[model samples]
Target: MGKSLLVLENLSPGRNLDAYMQSVSAIPVLSVEEERELTERLHYQEDLDAARRLVMSHLRFVVHVAKSYSGYGLPLGDLIQEGNVGLMKAVKRFDPTVGVRLVSFAVHWIKAEMHEFILRNWRIVKVATTKAQRKMFFNLRSMKKGLGWMNNDEVEAIAADLGVDAKVVRQMEGRMAASDTAFDAPVSDDDDSAYQAPANYLEDHSADPAHQVEHQNWEEDSQRRLMQAMGELDERSQDILAQRWLSEDKATLHELAAKYQVSAERIRQLEKNAMKKIRVTMEA
Candidate 1:
């Protein structure tokens, strides 16, 4: 993991996505026989060289798959990198006995990684979270005819096709159409425009005395509950919890082990049990 991160850290896909794409494209695709040989060697013999070759040959395919997600407004390089990670994962799990080509099996994994990346970075507020919404988000983008808003008929068609309500389709449409705005007025804004910013008109709930008192009560009650729970624990359990979690400079398992004259694993088990007991007591 460390080695992979170090290698990928030097790769700036956003700097020159075209150049990176061209580089991956130049890598040769493996023939069916060649792929099988590599897959068999990796699967049966656990050959790292075979795995490396398999991943190298499929780098171009990752780029190809990444291209379809270009509409998400993210850099092509980032998408391709994410796809490459998916490809590597697929390669790791490739089964020679599956009776299918590696690319066919890998497409799902590759697209899944790219989809996650797109959803995470596409909007300030997530546009799609549920499995159904994710399916609709991708399908809706492709189904729409043009940049214009979908008409009533179009919305109904999309709703029926995606197995969702028309209102849901409209909601997603509105979310996609929305753009991010500054929370405060820009430096160049005049007095008139400054008042239009969210900061100017938004209510400050923190300043409300009722809210402040309620928050303070909640905090004090939580602390009281925690102390009560801690008091319920045995001396050893209390010490373990306090040293491991509540201390400014926390104690390590080995250090605790030495102090208690117990194995580090035993210390870890005690720590785990102590936490579980604390949670149970607090909840009760």
Candidate 2:
């Protein structure tokens, strides 16, 4: 009962789809008596072996269902793998007393998984999110006859059939019609076409030559002022500030206290007073 029903032993659809399909196809269909016995073993005794047998026999069905979703442009092997997951879930919950064949019960789960995969991988930006939108998304694809956009009558008819607003259908149609573009120009693009890339248009003003020079000059002035202020501090205070604030290996108050043979609190007070004078001098 605790073990997995789906036996995915090196049967990666992504790695080698043809071989995986052949392997699943080779698993024989279970007889009714055999199905019943396995179901009983799973339901009553929580037999993992029986669950595995039941799943193995029905893998062909998952493959069949996954094939229908090939139009979404997803890898067929990935779809089959997802459907197998759904089948396992269905088997894990299947009861001997359900009175329906495992295929009938498992169809929903299998299709649900496939549908999720399609919605996710079909686009970088999701076209469908809501329950209503999801229903419309799948239906709209089938309803569409060609590459051309749907007309007013077609939109109205689809909306009526699907029990949603025509506006929603139009929006989803637009989303499906839209294609993703890379931000930067492609390597193969010539200089003539390169200007069309978003990277060319969306320039960062902060990195402009004029702005870079202004920022660098301002930073240098600030650092010069900070150094002049530090030079005004007493030798002990300047050493503490340099070790604690300016050094790559910053000295702790306790470490400074050990070096100076003073209490940590005394070092902390000296650091604080030196910082206040530096800030005042820099601001001036």
Candidate 3:
């Protein structure tokens, strides 16, 4: 089967999309008897020739599914390519005994591959992560009637139909409406437009010298106060506090209790008292 699949690799949709479409369309569609026979040969006998015939016959269906996703701004060739992958997977897992045509079973796999491709390449940041959002992302586009934003009533209607909150519908609409922008503006001869890029005006406050110095001083002061407060406690209390909080591998309450030869509750009490005293000292 591996060698047979490789033979059909050249038939894949490529840069010459029109030619690829024509070629796949030219291949004759299989009859019910022919399809069943090929599927059985591939399924039970592991016949590579039967597998190749099955995949080749299904190429036209893959193209048809990929065309519906043309609005996503992805290359049609790429969409067809992804759909082809799904078709191949469907072929590999297909059971002729299921009493369903291969085309009916393959539709889900075909659309699934194309969906993943769109989500990955649609934007610089992902627009949909959850199951509901993914469903909304595809359906909402078709549900929209015009170029303008959806009105409140339209939003509510679509939300109810899709079984999502109205807010979620609006959120996905916003994501789809947005377009990618370059952080740095393209090089232009016009001076006025050059300063409009995000890189020109957005400030990085972390790099400011005053902020850096203030953050460093605050951290040092906090550390100094913590040390002073801890020093004021008894030696045993200090050891417990250090083991519980300061050590790289901090001791658990039960472990500390075993070492101190006390119950776990006693260790919790000591830890609580130590934290309270530290907080009071730091605040003072």
lDDT of 3 at 198: 85
Q: Rank the candidates by lDDT, best first.
A: 2, 3, 1
TM-score of each: 0.69, 0.67, 0.88
Q: By TM-score, how accurate is candidate 1?
A: 0.69
Worst 10 residues of 3 by lDDT: 1-10
lDDT of 2 by residue, 125-196 (tens): 999998878888899998887889999999999999988899999999999999887899999999999999
Please provide, for model 3 over 100-207, each residue's C-alpha lDDT reduced to its tens digit, 9 standing for 90 to 100.
Answer: 999999999999999999999999989998877898999998899998999999999998998879999999999999988788988763788878888889999999
Clashing pairs in 3: none
Best by lDDT: 2
Better of 1 and 3 by TM-score: 3
> Model 2, stretches more than 4 Å misplaced?
1-10, 202-284
The window of 10 residues in a row where model 2 has the poorest summed lDDT is: 1-10
What lDDT tens digits, residue by residue, belong to model 1 across residues 15-85?
77766666556567788999999999999999998998788778778888888888878988899889988
lDDT against the true structure, each candidate: 0.87, 0.90, 0.89
lDDT-best of 1 and 2: 2
Candidate no. 3 TM-score: 0.88
lDDT of 3 at 188: 61
Candidate 1, run of 10 with poorest lDDT: 1-10
